[model samples]
Target: MKRHTAREKAFQLLFQMDLNEFDPNEELHEHHGEEEIDSFLETLVQGVVQQQTTIDENISYHLENWSIRRIASVEKTILRIATYEILYMEDIPTNVSINEAVELASKYGDEKSGKFVNGVLSKIIA
Candidate 1:
């Protein structure tokens, strides 16, 4: 799968994991069924899972006058994914991570989500 597509699927899986509290491996198998799992997708989901506390801490630190808890789950999840990429994924450029995250927020989150994500990620990379 293309990185874009893998990222999208990873977002969906992570979103579900956030909402449902399911294990990533089980959820991923259920998600793909007979299809082979995408390596990038697996890497993203697992990386986010392993590093979530650090990612959330980073995101929370970047927020201005906002508690991480107050953020909507969609925005929070998007932020987590982007933050993970920025901090952990050396191969992907920070700009690419931010742009892709903004796109995901624009597509899946509320009206303000894209800007909110961009703002927070900009702070993260700054």
Candidate 2:
């Protein structure tokens, strides 16, 4: 089985929350056919949700003239995923995290969202 992209999975969970007020933790079982999620991605998703305040802080610190609350839902989700990967998963290269984040933003976020994710992550990595 192909593993679902973390952002893609997160997108579904977040969308469900937005529309139905369901808990994200409980909603994850509704997996669509996709790549098998590795342990790393599972950790990333959980870490992001568990340490959202720290992730939001990292984003706020790196994002000039932007607040975490003001970011779009898609962009925010990508940021949280990538930030968690960056901070918690040492095995995944920094470049891969940044690239995945950019891809996620492009697919789910607005036109400007990819650039924003890239910029903030670059700062965090540097």
Candidate 3:
């Protein structure tokens, strides 16, 4: 899978996991059906899950006035995904992560989500 497609799928899987309390394995199976899971997709989902606490902490610190819990689920999920890539995936450029996250936000979240994601990620990257 292309990185873009993998990232989007990872966001969907993680979003379901966060909102519906679905198990990762179940979501993965459900999402891919009989197809082999993309390695990057699996990596993104697992990496976000494994490093969630630290990622949340990083986001919380970078947030201006809003608490991490106060952010909408979509925005929070996008933030976590981008933050995970920024912090852990040395091969992907930080700007690429941030830009992709903003795209995800614009597609799946409210109109303000893109800017909100970009702002928080900018702070995190700094």
* Best by the lDDT measure: 3
Give stretches of model 1 more than 4 Å off: none
Query: Residue by residue across 1-126, what tens digits does model 1's lDDT show?
Result: 999999999988888888899899999999889999999899999999999999999999999999999998888888988898889889999999999999999999988899999999999999
lDDT of 2 by residue, 21-126 (tens): 6654445544533544545445655677678788888888998888888887778777878888789888878898898889888887788889989999999999
Q: Number of clashing residue pairs in every model? A: 0, 6, 0
C-alpha RMSD of each candidate structure in angstroms:
0.8, 3.1, 0.9
**Model 2 accuracy (lDDT, Cα):** 0.73
lDDT of 3 by residue, 8-40 (tens): 999988888888886787788787899999989
Candidates sorted on lDDT, descending: 3, 1, 2
User: Model 1, residue 48: what's the lDDT?
Assistant: 96
Ranking according to TM-score, highest score first: 1, 3, 2
**Candidate 3 lowest-lDDT run of ten:** 22-31
lDDT of each: 0.92, 0.73, 0.93
| TM-score head-to-head 2 vs 3, winner | 3
